[model samples]
Target: MPAVSAVSAAPLPAPPRTLGTGLLLVVLVVAFEAMAVGTVLPRVASELQGLSLYGWASSAFLLSSLFGAVLGGVLSDRRGLAWGAGFSLAVFAAGLLVGGLAPTMLVFVLGRLIQGLGAGGLGALPFAVVTAHYPEAQRARMLAAVASAWLLPALVGPLVASLIADTWSWRAVFWGLVPLLALIAPLCLWPLRGPAPRVGEGSGGAGLLRPALGLALAAGALVEGLRSPGPLGAGLVGLGGAGVVLTARHLFPAGLLRFAGGLPTALAVRGLAAFALLGANSFLPLALHELRGLSLTAAGWVLSLGGATWTLGSWAQAQAERRWGPGSRPLRVRVGLGLMATGLLASALAVLGGLPLWAVYPSWVLACFGMGVGYNSNSLYALAAAPPGESGRLSGQLANIEVLMVAVAAGVGGALIARLPLERAFALAFAVTLLAAVLGWLAAGRLRRTS
Candidate 1:
């Protein structure tokens, strides 16, 4: 990882004495928060009797998450990680409390918005933390640990959420994280040896907010558009297109708008990869439970298992990153996507073949592993391409690409599932995954040198 030390931002601050048990624990708690939501969401919808707005609950979190993450990047780059992490954790806790106590559907949705903002910040802020404080070798290891932190949560989040929802209430799942997030503030201040603020992002970062919002609006509107009827749907589509144009002008370099030097193409591949996988995977739990007749607990376990395998895939990529540097990223990404396609096909075939729900768990795990591998591969290559100072902002933009793509994909995937048989819908998704993998592979071939 140090061979790529040139990629680290200039004159890096000393990292913590060590990543420490506390920091890892903080990461674990956060990852569990992420995984818990999926399990509890259905229960919330059923209890609240707002099935029509079910997708909004998730989409709202995702949208706000985009905002929070991008904002965190800018904030952390300007302020120190301490303040950034502090603000984000407080926001996250408040959202959870609001969600747990909400009495109305609208209130619940608002709470999700708040949580999404926090979640967005929490997700990418860790990357900023690593880049800012840790040495290259230790930073890479911490990143790997951060990846692994998701494993325990992935193993238990669903199961725990399922039990809470079934035996007690869904709201408990939200409230549960409050005490956990409470620790982040104090933990942040303890290792307080850095310069208070790392560096200011200047006008370029500040100017980006409007476009991020536009992108978010475009994404939300695009998903919402799919739900409308007749001319109203057309209106929504038109609005979404405008939002995309607005966001594009702000997000990409001028050359990218003109399709120069594969910038737009790079962004497109990132978007497509996320869309094909995240979009398809979003509805998979429902497919297993609703179509295959698995219990909530069983479905939850399957998802958790998949999450666990995702960590493994990410871990493997870290090793690959060390051994292969930028040269091998494309092959890894291609393989990751190929695995995704294979997993999707296996899942689709299991459904088509009427394999018992219990028998098909491994397929979803494979899909998860594929997603993890491809995702990290994308990150290493993309980050290696950018100027070190731009890493935080570029990461935020890439994150926006991922979340926006998933938003669109989920809506599209949802509609497809509604119209077609579960198996056939899955097959179509698998085909799309294959296409994205091909695109990623082709693009990867351009990266012979680290430059």
Candidate 2:
């Protein structure tokens, strides 16, 4: 005891409590908004007579978020995390206000676009914070904590939103959260104040921002084309597809589409997984409400169940990482992808093959749980591999890919839904998701770099 060194005797410093709390609160609020909106979207569409534009509600946000993610990343790298975070939070709040007061579907979509800008930044900043602030050992735990933030929101958000919508108005759901943002803003920003620690040479604005704008515009065009009918729609789709192809090369790491090893594969896996799970999830409430004849509250229960399992799965992966170490990531991702595919297949059968309606609950749970496991693991893998001073950029790229894929999936699904009967459209959507999951599972094997 007398020979003990002061350094050895001291316990490791924990991550800033206020900062972590603020970040988690941000995640909590964002997750709640997502769940609530999904639950109430049918109602919104019906009231606003926007069934044709149902997909735009989600796509617009995602597309605009593409720009936000890149801009936030650039600002975080150059100006500082606090500056980017403050700007993002403010934009997010403004979007909510606009959405709450929207007089028409067009106005509501405009609000969503604004929200995407802020939400995208908010989504990417946490990863940058984790990279800059936390030690390697604590990173996984932090990511898991972020996932855990979804727990309360998932458990109660949809149900509460449904109740609010029934008792008051869906508009309340958007307005209710704005004040909470005010409370959390200080907690998150205070710890991150001042100049960002010098890491490396910051990337320039134009190279990233230009592509981000192109990506968002391309995605928007694609969604609109999907919703449109006739040859004009086909032409728009082609144009959007070409634009995405050209712009994507500038935004993502090289060999992304081909699933090159390490970062590329990880990003691809995450994007495809999100496309499968979230794409299917977007249509789930609608399916339950329209095809299965469930009440909004009952449909919300299904989503809540999925959210609960998702949290459990995330924690389980974290525990596994603790026990087996980082080497287990590929296995975890592969296993999660398998479960997702299985769940999606089961969901499709339930919708089309005459399986009982209740089959969807367990199936969704499995799918979401897989997402919880794989999505977090993918983030860890990518962050661990990030070049010095590029965490913000990497995080933005990751968020961009996920957002883009989900937007496309949802937009395509909505287009189908508008064209086909409810049952067929939902079944086909599930099939698309299932295919994505299967492909992601195959790609999971490539997560590690080859010699």
The number of the candidate with the highest lDDT is 2
Lowest lDDT 10-residue stretch of candidate 1: 1-10
Candidate 2: where is the Cα deviation over 4 Å? 1-13, 39-55, 103-105, 165-170, 199-204, 288-296, 449-451
TM-score of 1: 0.86
Each prediction's whole-model lDDT (CA): 0.69, 0.84
Among these predicted structures, which one has the highest TM-score? 2
Model 1, 196-263: lDDT tens per residue?
A: 55343432666777777778888777777766657887788789868877786777555443323333
Model 2 agreement with the true structure over 278-315: per-residue lDDT tens digits: 89888887787887688876876777888888888888
Model 1 stretches with alpha carbons more than 4 Å out: 1-5, 8-14, 17-23, 166-168, 189-193, 196-203, 252-268, 289-299, 354-363, 386-388, 420-424
> Where is model 2 poorest over a 10-residue stretch in terms of lDDT?
1-10
Task: Score every model by TM-score.
Answer: 0.86, 0.90
Residue-level lDDT for 160 in candidate 2: 89
> Candidate 2 clashing pairs?
none
